[model samples]
Target: MTSHNTFHKVVVLGGGYAGTLAANRLRTRDDVAVTLVNPRPEFVERIRLHQFAARTGDATINYRTLLGKGIELVVDSATRIDANTRTVRLASGRALEYDYVIYAVGSTGEPPASVPGAVEHAVSIAEFESARRLRARLDALPLDAPVTVVGGGLTGIETAAELVERGRAVTLVCGRALAPTFSASGRRYIATWLSRHGVSVLRPAAVSEVRQDAVVLADGGVRPSALTVWTAGFGVPDLAAASGLRTDALGRLLTDETLTSVDDDRIVAAGDAAAPSGQPLRMSGYAAGPLGARAADTVVSRIAGTEPAVIDLAFTGACVSLGRRAGIRQLARKDDTAVNLYIGGRMGAAIKEVTCRFVVAKRIRREADKPGSMSWPKGGPRPAGTVSPAETASSAGEVASP
Candidate 1:
């Protein structure tokens, strides 16, 4: 949109949903040079990580296909960012200067060493490499091997359900109630589905430590587990914080309502790593696409010397796949409160499958074909004094609430 003849260099760190969206959409401008930096050459479908761990499908989309022409894709990691010099230092000993920077690095899983004795016994499918390792482990295990999944969040639920469907003996460990934010009816439905699949749900039970062949519970009870999959919570990379950018408690980059850094207008943020208005957003699908687009639009507006609108996101529903053939879609209020509306059983499964097929590139294609094709939840614009995403847990692996 800018009339300037000079090309603007834009460096996008991380190639997650938000990073991909920003890189692709920014290509709509002929005057901008978009360079996407990611550690892997392939695009990771983080949504299907559980399925990947269950040997359902590979969790990759060729980055070559996802990114359009004119966008440079760098296969490397950003080791540091020097805001004073406006440059990004990569792990490969290379550096790139940029007119604008997009911080879209998403959430990640911790290694076993992160938790007590977990490294020696547990596994996590938080990234493509880790997911591949999990799939390999699943392939090598016996059919009746007992696998315990820690965390009652969406990732834990999906991983537990998927493994159970594959005929593995599965148990879900939760520090609190399963799907605690969901409405009573929604929780009941989840419980019913999990029970029907023969998955053991251990609620009010916390895994104090993960052992090689057993899990030590908070109550001093030990449960035998041939395999342990950790899906508890996700944490963001410390790149922003390490680079001297202001970050929240969870290390998410702090931004203003327009999705730009409160300290530097040259920097913008979106996706899970963005904390706007002193509040952080949920690290789930609920915020990914919407925040990604808003961040891109803000960068574009800035280039064109126009003001970008404050990010206004809404909530509609979430789709969670129980297995290959069963799923649940939970609708919610604009503020993301669970409602009684839901579609369960085979129909919900079909809906979930359709949603999974939605890749980040499709969004770029839409933007190139349609100028204002942003999809908002519940028609967007929250009501006065409504709670924002900071108040709720946005697990990428969950969908239904009502």
Candidate 2:
């Protein structure tokens, strides 16, 4: 039998906020060998994807800078996880064994399959490569091009505002009131900021179909657009479900409050891919990093023959970036209920910018330097009635499209 002090191997799938943090925090254990698997060589900061799509920022972080010295970086995609064999099969024909696995592939643009013609016509700013494609497409378009942004979430808001700030004729189609998750005051600030940036807002307007050059509204109204960017919602990878792991409807790996897999004790989940207590955790980097750390702690505790504690995640608020120069900060309670408090205009924009920077760079770097240095807001237990944005999109795999 392997002794408790025997060297243990851990493989982290996905190099996003959660996966990276999980791997970094695992460095503290000298007996654990950590290997991170990712498709790209550079870490794409999904949070700043809109800034990159707008040509206002660079979001690529080289693995050399973000990954710690003890973690080995493998450039590949995981196609299958064989829990029976305790191995992961890669697209590159490599098989990796692990004492524990962290599934944190995060999310990507909602597949264009949600709407007719969307796959063929609409563009997006959901990931690094997708944002690059959008940037290039925008660069080729004329300055006066009419652009339509779908969805009222933060991504939609930031994308429309960024384009409008660049002098593009922008319109946002919100199926409901803008920023539905935000407080009324927060929503007002965002609406006003977009208006000031010359972005036309369409509310209570539903899009029935996306065309080659426009979107068809549910009311049978057709709006012409030179380019349509779909920011509707996001969908996570289906690896967990495919691997026969217990997952929520959206394929998010199901875990107990301790972040341990319900089916396999050797497996855990974090970030956008984790569904703890049958509830999908918050999608933001703020929640993802801490969840990853918690997963690491759980696995470490198990290896050390100790009882692991349950997850304690709290949401402080949501920061909506209107553009490079404007934003809205919505304060919230522990359960993610928006309060009546908000900050807007340039001040909000600055705060949002700093927060993004810290999430993408500063915080992870600090944690890499000093393992376990990171901390997250842990309010009361997650309220039963409150559903996170991720859970709202959860379905029999028909999740929201980004």
Candidate 3:
């Protein structure tokens, strides 16, 4: 077993925004050896995954350009983690023991099996491989083939617009309000843009089932859809729960405000895979960087024999690109509730593009060049009646505070 007093061995799972940033930030201590384990050799710009599937852009970057010096990158999937032994078992049957592990495995777009045919017929734009498959399917489709995007969220909206820009007939089937997270004005603006762009918009229309050639609506109406893209929600990996670490309902590792796992201080959680105080932040690249940095800070503070600070990362706004020419930048309060203020059209599109590039080349790579350089807005106050992990564990007699 690795000893933190002499040298800290930190293992970061996943190479997404959170994992990559956490691994980079671990460079704050020269005595800390950082190893980033990922299934892919490169980093996926998750924010641009929609554009990637639409062939508007590529979403991968070489880890050489993103990882800091001396941080080892392991190209393997972790099958399970043994929390008792502080070891991660990989699919290749290799074991990696660590003094600390950062759970940043990120989220996936796998459609729920509850929706008949969705798991088998619908494609997802959430992950790199799924997006690649969606792209190949799109490439082989007729230009006028009708494509249906099922979801009112940013991913579905962006994907529908991108497909339309590629000269494909597209339909956005929002189970509820279009751009539900956006303010009323912002949704109106996006709706207008889509209407002008020749994309059909359907709201309050849920997909009961996704078939190969059509989608059966909740109203029992059938819409011809050559391709169906599901982006309703995301799910995190079961790594935490499988390892006997506590997780919230969505399988995100439950952590304290400092991102330390409830089960062990040696384990930290970040990004979409972390449920801090039973409340996970918005699953976007915007939140991933700050969460990743904070998780790294927790591990570093432990090695330095200091109390880690609580998370104070705030959300400023959300940007959604409508094709490459238009977008909506919806401003929000620190708590992430949408406000009336917003910017739309080409200006919004420009800002969204810059934000995407900044997240990768500037925000992440800058941290790689200089550890602990990443910063975010101070977060709002925690909600009332929020329970800390230690408190919850104590009440259940599962774990005692250190």
On lDDT, the leading prediction is: 3
Taking every candidate in turn, the Cα RMSD to the unseen true structure, in Å, is: 4.0, 3.9, 4.4
Task: Report, for every candidate in turn, its global Cα lDDT versus the true structure.
Answer: 0.79, 0.82, 0.86
- Lowest summed-lDDT stretch of 10 residues in model 3? 393-402
> After superposition, which runs of candidate 3 have C-alpha atoms over 4 Å from their true positions?
1-5, 383-402
Candidate 2: tens digits of C-alpha lDDT, residues 53-126: 88888889888888777799999999999999999999999999888998888887753686788888888777
Instruction: Quote the positional error of residue 155 for candidate 1 in Å.
Output: 0.8
List the candidates' TM-scores in order.
0.91, 0.93, 0.95
How well is each residue in 1-402 modelled by candidate 3, as lDDT tens digits? 446577789999999999999999999888999999999998998888888898889899999999999899999999888888989999999999999999999988788799999999999988999999999999999999999999888888888999998899999998778888788998899899899999999888999999999999999999999999998888888888888888877788888888898878899988888887776777888888889999999999999999898888667779999899888789988877789999888999999988988888877899999999988899566544435666644221010000
lDDT of 3 at 120: 91
Ranking by lDDT: 3, 2, 1
How would you order the candidates by TM-score, starting with the best?
A: 3, 2, 1
Misplaced by over 4 Å in model 2 are 1-5, 383-402
lDDT tens string, model 1, 1-402?
656558899999989888887787787578998999999998888888888888876688887777767789999999888889999999999999999999999887764465698877788877888788888888998999889999887788888999999999999998788876666777788889999999999998988889888999989999999889888777789998889877777778777777888667889998888877656556776577778788888889999999887788777767778888888888877777779888888998898777776545346456545434756654454323422334322212222211
